[model samples]
Target: MRVLFILILLANLGVYALGQGWLGMRPEDEGRDTRRFTQELNPGAVTLTPRPAP
Candidate 1:
């Protein structure tokens, strides 16, 4: 039982490291256009309005 628990723990750690991008760039982020974020027009002009209460 202890061996199984240790194996599971290591697997979880490996997944966590991959998700955190500790190894390298994440696969999902490849070929993504990052310039759009910097090219926003009047980004500060957007405002969040509170919804009316029922």
Candidate 2:
């Protein structure tokens, strides 16, 4: 039972390490591209108009 507990503890630690990017695996490197959202086509063309009264 002690060995099983140790194994479980080690597994949890490994998962935590990977999640924290300590294992050289970054979240941004895994197909999470943010370029499209950051690069807007026209910044000056956007205008917010007030809603018409009912």
Candidate 3:
């Protein structure tokens, strides 16, 4: 039981160090997928109705 606790603690410490850049983990550059879907979207056809005074 004590060994499991120590292992978990060490794992958490390693993750914290990696997150804080202490372990020299660099950020990865991801490529964006610029493929557009063929769906028709009428964004300029919005009609806003005014509400009556309460």
Candidate 4:
């Protein structure tokens, strides 16, 4: 039972790691993504400029 549990736990961990790492987002795509998706899904929307850092 313990071995089975460990195997299942390892498998779950592997899947979680794969998803968190492989499926993770690219840091470079953040800003453009919002505007890109917004315009694609909704027309006639004005895009706001990035806020200046405080």
Error of model 3, residue 41, in angstroms: 36
Candidates sorted by lDDT, best first: 2, 1, 3, 4
Better candidate number, 3 or 4, judged by TM-score: 3
RMSD values, in order shown: 3.8, 3.4, 8.1, 9.1
lDDT of 4 by residue, 1-54 (tens): 999999999999878766665556544554565655555555558577899999
Ranking by TM-score: 1, 2, 3, 4
**Candidate 1 residue lDDT tens string, 1-54:** 999999999999988888887877666777888787789789799999999999
**TM-score of every candidate relative to the true structure:** 0.54, 0.53, 0.47, 0.42
TM-score, candidate 2, is 0.53
Model 1 TM-score, all chains together: 0.54
Is candidate 2 or 3 superior in lDDT? 2
- Residue-level lDDT tens digits of model 3 in 2-53: 9999999999998888777687742431253324345447867987989999
List candidate 4 segments past 4 Å from native.
22-54
Alpha-carbon local distance difference test for all models: 0.85, 0.87, 0.71, 0.70
Superposed model 1: Cα runs more than 4 Å off: 33-54
lDDT of 2 by residue, 1-54 (tens): 999999999999998888888998666567767577789899899999999999
Instruction: At residue 30, give the lDDT of candidate 3.
Output: 26
